[model samples]
Every structure is written in structure tokens, then in C-alpha cells.
Target: MTTKMREEIDEIPAAAARLLDTQTDLIRDCANALKKADPKTVVTIARGSSDHAAYFLKYAVELQLGLPVASLGPSLASIYEAPLKLGHAAAFAVSQSGASPDIVAMARGARAGGATTISLVNTIASPLAETADFAVDIMAGPEIAVAATKSFVNSIVAGLAIIAAWSEDKALVQAVDALPEHLQSALALDWSALLEPLREAESLYMLGRGPALAIAAEAALKCKETCELHAEAYSSAEVLHGPVSIVGRDFPVVAFAARDRAEASVAQTISKLAAGNAACFITSDKATGGEKLPFIATGHPITDALALIVPYYGFIESLSRARGFNPDKPVALKKVTETQ
Candidate 1:
């Protein structure tokens, strides 16, 4: 029987298509609001997988719009009751459940602070949605797995759509429109070569640059969440600073290098690691050293980076089962963490 996580992974393309088809108007409206606000900077609120999604958007917003994006800690509102002065900013609250108390409180706080708050959420009727000036239903359907797959993808997809519309970037709009097909291609990729090195490994490093760094972070979290393995994510350059000391012969390193400006730097980093006898693997054709894992190019840098996660989701689910853990039910975790 296929695990719920695998099933959700398989549904990613369709979920993305559903969001594009159904929520285009809502996304456009949100984009219009952002344009009207003309905020100097952007802030995001999320936790867990959703936080990783926010991280991805932070890079996207910075790269595409030249607007700095910051991730606000939810505790600022729920615990400290500190008032946020965000009148000159736009806030994006990303959540699958949209019911986490801290997340909701932060969204309300952002709106109260005069930010043009937008929510990208799976549950349309959620408190986060109600609190935002505009709520975009991610349209990922009902995800049963505790480990988020489709919803996570859809949240980023929705955010990317809004970015495309807000910036009025024709190329980005076209790229976002073609994501469903690209994601389908991404799902068919095989990264089984990673299993041999990662199966019994106690810990590993996931490396990337720019937006792919966020993908690396998500991959590391999934490794710990599903396979019960210890994984750390770092920028391709940041790892060389100190973490490189820990790498030895056969140390597993997965580098997520999208077809972007950062690809050469990422490839260079992984090549150095591979030369040092680390079991380095990369998702780029440009890497001279290390085994190249299959990846789809979605005709846009951000989309290309986002596509890396699909095959990764498949690989992690399989690794979890191989390691004798259920991907659907990781220990000490629940589907919705409603922290106060």
C-alpha cells in the first residue's frame, strides 16, 4: 500500500494545477493590493514546512522585486504581545492548517499594524484567512499525511503566482502557468542513488544557494521528520566556513543547484567536497565533480529550484520506509501544531 505521503507527493502537480485554475483571480486581487500598498519591505509568518515555504518566498521576493523580505517570529504577538509597526510593509502569512494560534495572532497583528496582509492557506475558512486583507486558498485538497507534501508545494505555488502578477513579469507568469507540467516531469525523476549513502548515515548536509537554499532547508527538515535522520542545510558558501571540517570520506552531501546565477557557485562547492572524498551529489549539469541527480528545469530560476523538491519528497518517503519508519506518522509530531 502506498503511504499517504507518497500519495500526496504524487498529487503535487494536480494540486498546483487546481490552484492556478481556481485561484488566479484571488491571487491577482492580492497582487493588486500589494501594488497599491507599494510597501518598502515584506514580512512573512509561518512555522515548520510552512516556514520553509516562507523562506523560499523571501528569496523570490528579494530576487524578483528587489524588496527585502523578513520572517517574523510568531512569538512576537502570542507571547510578548509586542505591537508591530508594519505600516510601510506587506505581510504574507503562509499555513496549511491556518489555525495555529501564534500564526493567526501574528496575521492579525500584521493587519492591525497597517500592513496589507495576505494569507496563502489550504483551509479557506481558517482564522488566518479571516484575518488577512486577502486570502488565497492554495487548493491542495485534503492532505492526510502529517508530513506536508502537496500543501507545501501549493503554498509556494500560490505565492509565486501572486509575485508573478504583482511584478507583471511576463516570463514569470508564463513559467508559473507551466508549473503543473514541469512538476509532473519532476515527479518522474529518480534519486535512488542517494539511498545507499543516506540509509545508515547518522547525519548529512544539504547545500544550495539563493532560493535553492530554502529547498535545501526543506529537504533537511524532511530527512529528520520522516527518515529520523540528522540533516543540516547550509548555503553552499556558508558550509565552507566551518562545517567543511566535519566532512570526511564518504560523508553524504546533497547539493540542490538550480539553473540560476548561483548554480556555478553551488557546483563549485560540491565539486570541492567531492574531491575531498565526500559522497557528494548535485542536481546540476554544470557540476564537474559529484554524481549528478536528475532535476527538471522549469524555464525560470525560482521554479527550477522549486521543482527539486518533488523528487526529493519521493526519495525521502522511500528512505523513511527503508529506515523502518512510517513517513505518515513521524514520532512526536502532529498534523497541526496549534502552539500558543
Candidate 2:
């Protein structure tokens, strides 16, 4: 990254991350949408890294809120792939720049089919934001890094806040307000010890399960975009399905175990891979001071949204430095990606 982008990332710790002043209003508005509408169905539209966060939101919405959630990939909604209304019930499209034509095209189709549209995006005047019936800005502010480290975390939290507001869960709403700060704390972490290890890697895998899987997916994406390395993401449970076959000593795995429910399963998965001679690193809140920590502390459940993402931001920064890649501007990617 250039000096300014690096300074901005480093400066994340200096400023206190806060809640959206409009989040309560957003909650009230989304609550109206849900109160007068169907909680039975919802659809998400996004692309690239935004799509991964959408996947995370979809799973969390379905599992936690009991809403049947479906994620609409941009390609599926594109004119080239198909012509269709993605979901007739309710639709929420999450994007950072909010100008992706594919997402806008899909939003039009959803609106045409009588679905209430909500656009959760960063820029208030963004095209996709303007196209929707309702819009909520993630409030992440101008993200200079093209890899989108902060916006992804903020989008998921905003999605969670919207769901929480509609569900009338005050705890989750409060949790969203607390999350950006929790992330600020994690972003302040000193990863100086991990430099030697990161430099020694031939390939890396960042794996997690449940809600943390969203973090793992983006971590891999960040690694690839920033370092041009062969980094991959796997659901901690899904890692056992077949990918474990390729385990070797040279492979390094960054395993995230943040949730109480899937934490044990992810731990067992980490152990399984470690026993196979894979070098493993763990991120958790329970590390003892005397022991060498493969860990980072995190706020759980709702705040886990940001807690999971902050360290990956650190990892991408380190990867960029390690490989001499500039995190500020990716070689071929633009601030607003418009893929056909």
C-alpha cells in the first residue's frame, strides 16, 4: 500500500469506531418493511468480496433469524447469464461502491417482480442505493484500499443490524454499535511475531466454520488480491470433506474459532489438520499470557461480525509487505469493479 493507505489502516486504531447515527432509523425503517411484509423469504445481490459477505449474511439470517435467505450472485442476475426476478418476496443488495451494473440490473428485476428492495451500501448517493426503495449506508467512509478490508466487515454488521432491528432484538442492535470499536481493538493488535512465519509459507489456507466462515472466505480473497498467492478458504467442517487429502507440512492454515457453538468442531478440525503435519495457527480469545498465542481476542455473537474480520485486514497488510504488492491499488482491479 502507498503511504496514505497504510497510514489510514494504521490509523484505524487511533479513532474510535462508532455506530451509524442513522442505524436506529434504519432499524425502524427495515422493521416496517418486515412488519408489513414476508419474513419467509429474502434475497441478496452482490459480487466478488461483497458476495462473500452476502453469503455470510444469508447463512446468518437463515440460521439465526429463521428467515429463508438466498444469495443472488451477479452472474446469475446478469443479462448474459439469465433474465429473471431473483426473489419475489423481499430483496436486499449489499455493495460497497454501489455502482455495479449487474447488481443494479438484478435490483430492477426484483422490483419489477413486486419485491420490496433495500440497498445496503456505502455511498449514500450511489446508483444502486438510489435504485432501491430503501437504503442504508454502511458508514465505513472512503475506503482507499481497493481490497475493501473495512467495508466488508461494516456491510455484514449493517445487515445484522437490519435483521436485528426487524427482529426487535435490542441486544443485537447494541452489539452492532459495539462492533466497530471491538474491531478497532483487534486492528490495533501487533502482528510483529507472525512475520517470519508468513514469509515462510508456500501456500496458505484461512479456514473457519459457521459465522466465522465469512471471515475465512474474505481472508483468502484478501491474500490473493494483495499478495498474488495461492491462498484458499474452507469451512472448518467442509475442510474435512476432501481438501484434507492435500495436507502437508509445508501448508499453513489460519484457523478461526470464534463462536461457542462451532468452536469445538473447528478446534477438532484444526487438530486433525495439525496431526497431519499441517502448520496451524488459531485465532481465539482464550489464550494464556505465558503460552505462545496463536490467538486474538474477539467479542462474540453479534460483535463477532467485526471481530472476525479485523485480523484478516492485518494479514492482508502483512501479505502486501511480504510480497512487495501495493495494497492501495491492485494491479488490475479498480475501486468499482464492473465485470460482465
Candidate 3:
């Protein structure tokens, strides 16, 4: 039987295409609003997989626009009732359910603080969407699995579209336009090389840099959430600082190296770890020592990094079943976590 997770993973490409095709007007409206505001900074609100998507966008916005982006803690409004001074900033609130109380509260607070609030959400009827100055439906459709697959990808796709339109970057716009096809190619990749080692391993490390670091983080979270594996994500540079001490023979490491300035650095770190007898695998042709995992390059750094997650989603769903667990209904987890 095909798992719900697998079905949703297969839906990613179509979901992205739907968002790009159906929500063009909303995305452009948000982008134009941002251009008018010309904010000095940007802030994001999210949690769980949505937070990981926001982290990806943080790098994209900073790299493309040279504007700093920060993640705002939702507790300020939901738990502590603290006032936010975001008069000169833009707030991006991301959520699939769009019903998380903290996330919605924070979006409302951001608007009250005078920021231009934009929401990228899967549910158009959600409170978060109603509260935002501009709302973009991510168009990922109904995701039945507990672990997000298509919705997560669509959230990032929506944000990237907004950034591409806002900055008027022809290169990024082209990349965004081609993402659906790239995502289809990404789904066809084989990452089974990671399975046998991870099956018996007690723990593992996921490494990357720049936008790929966000991919690593999402990978680690999926490992824990679906496969019940103990996986930690780190910057390729940061892992060597202190975490390398425990890396001994056959310590599994997966490095997500996109075709970007950080690719060589990540590959170098993987090489060092491989030299230490760690079973290192990297997703770049430039790798010197570690085994190379196949990945589709989307001709742009950000899109290339985003494509890494599709194959990983398929891999983790299979790993979960191989480890005697259901990927759809992870233990003690529900679809919507309404944290106050």
C-alpha cells in the first residue's frame, strides 16, 4: 500500500505548479506592498515544518535583497501579551493549517505594530489569512499525512515567488518558474544509499550551509518525526567546531551541498569527516572524499537547495516503514498543534 506520505510527496510538483499558476495575483500584490513599504527589515512567524520553511525564506530574502530577516517568537502575543515595535518592518506569517493560536496571534500583533503582514497559508479560510494585509493560498491541496510534505514545499515556493517578484530578479523568477519540473526530477532521485546505515545507527548528523542548512534542519526533523531516528542538523562549519569530537568510525553524516558558494565549503567539511572514518555522503559532484549522492541542480542556488528536500521526503517515509512505524500517524502527534 502506498503511504499517505508517499502520495503527498508525489504531489509536490503539482502543488508548486498550482500555487504558481493560481496565486500569481496574490503573490504580486504582496510583492508590490513590500516594494511600497520598503521596509528596513523582515520578520517571520511560524512553528514546526512551517518554521523550517520560514528559515529557508530568511536566507533567500537576505541573500537576494540584502535585508536582514528575523524570526519573531509568537509567545510575545499569545503567552506574554508583549507589544511589538515593527513599524518599519514586514512580517511574513506561514502556516499550513493557519489555525495555530500563537501564529495567528502573532500575525495580528504584527499588524497592530504597523508592519505590512503577508500570510502564505494552505487554508484560505484560516484566521491567519483573514488577519493579514495580503494573503496567498499556497494551493498544496489537502494533506492527510501527519508529517507535512507538499504543504511544506508549497509554503517555501510561495515565499520564494514573493521574493523573486519583490526584487524583480529575472534569474530568480526564471528559477521559480522552472521549479515544478525540477521538483519532478528531484522525486525520481535515489537516496537508498542512506537507508542501511541509518537503519541500525543510534544517531546521525545532517550538514549543509546557507539555504541548504534549512534543508538539513527539515531533514533532521523528519528523521525524528517520521522515522523515529535521532538526527541533528548543523552548519558544515559549525559541526567541526565541537560536534566532530564524537564522530568516530562509521558515524553516518549526510551533507546537503547545493550548487552555490557554500558547496565547496560543505564538501570540504564532508571530506574532513570522511577522513576521520565517518561514513559521509554529500549531494554535490564536487565532493572529494565522501560518497556522492545524486541531486538535481535547479540552476539557481536557492532552488537547487529547495530541490534537495523532495528526494529526502521520499527517503524518510520509506525509512519510517522499514523501521516498523507508520509515517502518516507519528506517535503522539496531531495535524494541528494549537500552542498558546
What does candidate 3's lDDT look like per residue over 1-340, in tens digits? Answer: 9999999999999999999999898889989999999999999999999999999999999999999999999999999999999999999999999999999999999999999999989999999999999989999999999999899999999999999999999999999999999999999999999889888887899999999999999999999999888989999999989999998775799999999999999999999888888998999987778788999989999999999999999999999999999999999799989999
Cα deviation in Å at residue 179, candidate 2? 1.5
Candidate 1 per-residue lDDT, tens place, 1-340, comes to 8999999999999999999999978988999999999999999999999999999999999999999999999999999999999999999999999999999999999999989999999999999999999999999999998999999899999999999999999999999999999999999999999998999899999999998999999999999999889999999999999999999875799999999999999999999999999999999988889999999989899999999999999999999999999999998889999998
Lowest summed lDDT window (length 10), candidate 3: 284-293
**Mind giving the per-residue lDDT tens digits that candidate 2 earns over 1-340?**
2544565565443222433554667757876886687646888888778888787888667766687877766666566556655344778888888888889878766777677888878888988888888888877777777887667766777777777777777777677667655666676666555456667666777787767777788878877777777788898878888888887777777776775577767777777777777777766543221112233344456456447566557756776777777877779777888765
Please, what is the whole-model Cα lDDT of each candidate in the order they appear? 0.95, 0.71, 0.95
TM-scores, each model vs. reference: 0.99, 0.89, 0.99
Q: Once model 3 is optimally superposed onto the true structure by TM-score, how far is the C-alpha of residue 96 displaced, in angstroms?
A: 0.5
Instruction: Write down the RMSD of candidate 3 (Cα, Å).
Output: 0.7
Off by over 4 Å in 1: none
Clashing pairs for model 3 are none
lDDT of 2 at 115: 79
